[model samples]
Target: MKKNLIMSFVLSTLLVTVLSGCGAASKSTTGTADDTKAPAATTTTKSEKSTTLRIGYQKYGTVNFLKANGELDKALKEKGITIQWTEFPGGPQLLEAMNVGSIDVGHTGEAPPIFAQAAGTPLVYLGHEPASPASEAILIPEKSEIKSVAELKGKKVALNKGSNVHYLLVKQLEKAGLKYEDIQVVFLPPADARAAFEKGSVDAWVIWDPFFSAAETSAKAKILADGKDTVANHEFYLATRNYAENNKETVKIVLDQLAKVDTWSKDHPKELAETLSPQLGIDVPSLERAAKRRAYGIQPIDDALINEQQKIADTFFKLGLIPKEIKVKDAVLPATK
Candidate 1:
């Protein structure tokens, strides 16, 4: 009977050992399964890469107001994007930088884009400001007797070549029954033109404000014609095609901030002038006059707008300003909606 009991105890001890070993192996298998899930969790949620936005702006554009107010910096900070601002004298220079891929986006007058497109620059029109027809004009000496655009014939007219005012001069001369070849177009920048005007060197000056207002206030200047009867006088925002395609969301943010500033400026013209006076180096009254003449609404580029721009392009081509015929819509982006 003692031998029987000893055999039963050995069987029970072996059974316990086998059960414990099975339990440990099962636990090891479960741990291996858990280890396999960690990689998938890592794959599902990856870290986002950082980005940068480089913008080119002119001294007197809406982008300048955006920079001064710090709206763009605040809006883009959370997206891990940095803002780099560079200033140019005018839209042509700004778009020149854009063509070289140095600037991601910029603001320019309408005619600059037309010329840029003619030159085969791959730019995209992002948005535009409403037409401020009276914002630009053709000025003669206040005491001069050139009463009509007709009198500008055979006279030296000072203006920036390929500028928005260039279109104005073309259209106005046409309306006055004068051919472009009738007048000698003098290509000079605003400052040089101003000096020539003061010295009575150029018979007339075609320019925009606050420079226009400054000329009027500082000297005797008279407006022969304003854009009200000639052109839309629209301001455009342009981006390179590559950047627009890659950074649509960042571009949307930029447009949103500009819209906000546009609204604010329209509501508070006096304050806008006060803010811009120091930056533009013009007096408050002149800036105020300019602010009033400015169109403060932002609109997306549409097919109709592209058609209008195409007309400008064709006009420039016919006038021998651009090399060949080009389509404005080819350099345009879809609405940011």
Candidate 2:
């Protein structure tokens, strides 16, 4: 399959990255690639010797808002660091870019990082936004007779593999007293999954916002179950271990600016959707609906959160989605004092 081949290429690229001891790419926000630029050596405390800070972001979340605000850019510029913004289709691909040293830090949901860490990608848990369990859900067609998660057994469900919604699907099934094998899972990206759901090729689709919000507004998809009782569905920010270790000051600057964005976003509820809609290509109403339930305030990774990540890792390994077991703590950076 084309998807399989693409993944194979990504894996091969990662192997070459690790083998060559090559540092991350210094690609600017433009399409240009700068493989010759390695990280600058840290000179002294608070110097943050790095000149360019590469970042990866998906269609949604903290970095996008932060970049748009330009406050982080101002702060980092004071420290002599500029940001390279690279967009990825999803968390897995973003982390793949991270593994290939394409970017330094990126944001993702709960499950992708577990898979990334399991594969031995040298990434560290940086920080997290507050949990928004209502952001993701198991959605059915507008008129489908299927009314509950239990009814989904034996039906085809579509979702992006190794995603936050993947675990949402799993936990929701268990709450319904069903096993992982109870349904047919079609692993597709958000766009393809949306198409499949619209065509009725799949009985239900598991997904997160703003896609979840878009579905409700556009297709009238019914929620069989949201993450509410099933999962935390926290959004996390991650960086390569090397990036975090050598450029701790730069990392702190990024998180600090994120905190500012969170405050402004929380205080301006209606504006959240209005501001993001243009970039996201979704209507303001849907973006508003999705943003309403999401909480703000980015916090450092803690043991309580680490335990939850561990549970996700254990569940994936049990389902044989991952080849081996992993420890969430192993990839975590200690909290900044």
The best candidate in terms of lDDT: 2
Lowest summed lDDT window (length 10), candidate 1: 36-45
Clashing pairs in 1: none
**Candidate 2, backbone clash total:** 0
Model 1 regions more than 4 Å off: 1-50, 335-337
Candidate 2: 10-residue stretch with minimal lDDT: 25-34
List model 1 lDDT by residue over 1-337, tens digit each: 9999999999999998754442121111111132211010011112332266767777576887897788788788888787767666567766666665556788988899998888877789999999888989999998899999998889999998888899999999999999999999999878789999999999999998778888887886898999996799999988888778777788889999999999998878789888988866888877777888889888988887888899999999998999999978678755542
lDDT of 2 by residue, 1-337 (tens): 9999999999999997674553342223522343344333232333345677878777768787887677887898888787777766678877776776677888999999999988888889989998899999999999999978999889999999888899999999999999999999999989899999999999999999889999999999999899997799999999888778888788888998899898888778568788888877889989888878888999878889999999999999999999999998999876531
Per the 3 Å backbone cut-off, how many clashing residue pairs does candidate 1 have? 0
Cα RMSD, model 2? 6.4
Query: How do all models score by TM-score?
Result: 0.83, 0.86
Show how many residue pairs clash in every candidate, following the order shown: 0, 0
Error of 1 at 65 (Å): 1.2
